[model samples]
Target: MTDRAKGWLVDLRPDERWDDEACCGDLPAEETRMADRLCDSASAATYIRARSVIRRGLAGLLGEPPAEIRLASEVGGRPVLPDHPDWYVSWSRSKSLLLLAARYGEPVGVDLEVIRPISPAAGVLRTVYPRTAELGAVDQSETFFTAWTLLEAAVKATGRGLARGARDVWLYRPSGESRCALGGIRNAGEVPWSGRTEQFAVPGSSTRVMTAVVTKGFTDPIHVDAWQLPDRPPSPVTAAAPRRLLRKEVSA
Candidate 1:
């Protein structure tokens, strides 16, 4: 199905297992090799887990075991979807939670932060967040992280490494906890289109949370499913933001 027809926004549980073979079965050796090559063990594991979750979700919808999807990339390091060429796939993870957004050719991006607090990353923030100067003074960790994730998500959406010039990109924050739309940088490409950002409490975990940014051309319907171990208290921070989208149609 095309992304514009409205599909799913899957929120995978860090602890539950699905019956789909595409997810639970053994992955090809090359896939495992790529994970092994990741810079950090924790990040690699998170990546593997997110891929599994996406495979399982896709299997259920396609009514067949998903095919082997490899993580190939261009010289610039952007992940290529050779198997699912028609779909745009973007995922992000923080701590135990994993977020996924799939849509049409329009680049899609998703990001989550373990809501607690982190010491500002020195001058890095100022370097990447030129718009922060216009944001006035703000000392809250959430404020900093919110802006940080937005820019990060935008870069991820562009498939450009965060170093390409994050400071040039800007996000318009209309309110402290309200949704902000992605826009262009003063001397950079605006990355074309719209997006939404929302926060959710970590289910059954008192010490964490998440925020997601899904960019323009995601005309697909939005669905968010939260999972938790049995008998755990429900997390009350689930939220979603979807916008009407029109994507450029390219010939096959």
Candidate 2:
């Protein structure tokens, strides 16, 4: 939760058409094949852009060339740097936004979702809503997304993903504040680990995008750096650089 974490938020809206060659030229061969298989141009472009952002961001953090950052996946399909096992990362993409979070040795998970009307379906309510039993009194849409993203972030942090079930994770909001915390993570009806959860709204956007980050264990105040991409390049992150430039701390 402390200022120890770093992240980047990139705009995924296509401002200019990038052909397959332009988009996949610098990607790894596997990624290029995956991109090539996508029939939708926008989806392919978004995939390429997200992978590029991850490479560049990790490269900046590791002080290496983007192409040289080798990435692998954990058991649950979470991406990891095989050489730097201590470095934890998570990625999420909404309609036109991609988010990345990284921290050394600490598990981190981030999720972004564009807010829209929630169907009053029983299945959705059961899967997304916390078991607090007070949901009937609040704004259903806001509460639904708040709970949804928090559970997602927490589950992702655990690396078990939805396989662990969102209902097993609870997000607790201390009345009358924008802040919240991971109440507990229950596996097989037993609490295992606690976490810190923070939510933010992307600035200057017409559509409402709700994002949340869950860091395992308790920590200091969480600082989120929301970067609008293609417009803002990744800040040069070097050990010798000024701390401010390394990770521009922003209040989200």
Candidate 3:
């Protein structure tokens, strides 16, 4: 079966009043405690928003109540559905933007980074991505962020994260495709990533936002969509109610 992945981008600007009760009331106890430990309201808000997006997105995909979807982190801080091991998910946030990617049948990872000038680009390139440095002089900010997101998405997909060393993964453009159209990652000391990847700009942002997704067994083209929160929150699910089972088939 061909694996399928879906992604959603959420904006975290303070313009909208975040419905804390509806968005975060269903979070697991551990997540609630972690949110409480955030140093400031902004950080807490961002965390809540990210979790809310994940729940809502997953709920829609699984046809279940958002409040009933529970997410837990594995050993390396990778999010997983304890009840559904077949599903894979990954998330990343940059400043006021958050990205969430999920797939069925195969693992997937996503990353987003705001493009900005990197003052000491050489140090970062030399330490984490010496191969990227050899690409020759280019837009320092764009090059660094592009390579950074690619490596992050690859590692996240593999579930090893940066602990495996960013330098260990190499990102390359496949022949006969736009730089953003197709990319691949090869891990030096681990199993290679033989999945599809797509990178694009986020919509409606003044600052350039770059995002990437790495998926296994997904050969189809990827589609990026903007996710808008519902104006009226759905009724919260009660503990007495039974949770719905994830559907075996997912629509493209």
Candidate 4:
């Protein structure tokens, strides 16, 4: 098996050419569905930036532009590339950032969350994060967000969203480079999802942000590049910026 088959995680920055502003415009129908679910401007902007990068990156891999691509939503509402079936793709973003990950022909899902400090009401921790309690009892506030991202990635990979239930998927803190398979998600029960983490330093400062990806095994040493979006602060990307989620024959 080639390295590409093994899958990979890439880190992209603003200096990269793929982050063109012209890429942003109207949201595809599928994305509008996702956008409607979000309530925050930061969330909306992040989604837009991520969508643009994913589309452009995939197009570049296919040697084409975003306009030439076509995407269809599965019954579950996840986006897929009409030209490619074997491949899986996902993107995510946060304040001043974006992330994308893809596997040649594998199911892929990615998520990024800014670790902001938060203190919730009593019983809230147990109701929302049951697994956190099993992690040997530590500071919930510090570990809450990290664990949250892992769950988000797993559910996104499953493509059922909250409808399948977030509690069905679980993750443990990383003890080694090898990631663990948590709970049953959609078709794959306790599927061993491979993943990687990225920490980016904000421009002109030392502030750092984190993002992560969960995907099927791939043989490729995932190629990572960057694009300077005209609107958002410089962020990172994996694969060519995605246009319409999953695509079969990516050009450029």
List candidate 3 stretches off by more than 4 Å.
1-4, 163-165, 173-205, 230-252
Query: Over the stretch 23-71, how does candidate 3's per-residue lDDT look in tens digits?
Result: 5564555665677666566666667667777777777666666667777
Writing each residue's lDDT as its tens digit, candidate 4 over 1-252 gives 222322222233334443333334323545645744566544444565556666655554444455445667777766687787766667666655666665676676667766555565124445655555554433443355445556667667778674454666665554542322343344565435565555455556564555556675534535444324322223333223233321211221
Q: Which segments of model 2 are wrong by more than 4 Å? A: 1-4, 16-26, 121-123, 128-139, 165-167, 176-180, 187-205, 219-222, 230-252
- Per-candidate clashes, comma-separated: 3, 0, 0, 38
- Over 219-245, each residue of candidate 2 has an lDDT whose tens digit, in order, gives 532355665432223433221212221
**Model with the higher TM-score, candidate 1 or 4:** 1
Error of 1 at 30 (Å): 2.2
The local distance difference test score of each candidate is 0.51, 0.62, 0.63, 0.52
RMSD values, in order shown: 12.3, 8.9, 8.3, 9.3
lDDT of 1 by residue, 77-170 (tens): 5555676666566666665566665565566666677766555542446775655666544356555666677777677766765677465567
Per-candidate TM-scores read 0.68, 0.74, 0.75, 0.63
TM-score of 1: 0.68
Q: Which stretches of candidate 1 lie over 4 Å from their true place?
A: 2-26, 32-48, 58-64, 121-124, 175-181, 185-192, 228-252
The alpha-carbon deviation from the true structure for residue 5 of candidate 2, after best TM-score superposition, in angstroms, is 2.3
With candidate 1 superimposed using the best TM-score fit, by how many Å does residue 202's alpha carbon deviate from the native?
1.2
Off by over 4 Å in 4: 1-21, 24-50, 121-129, 138-142, 174-191, 205-207, 221-252
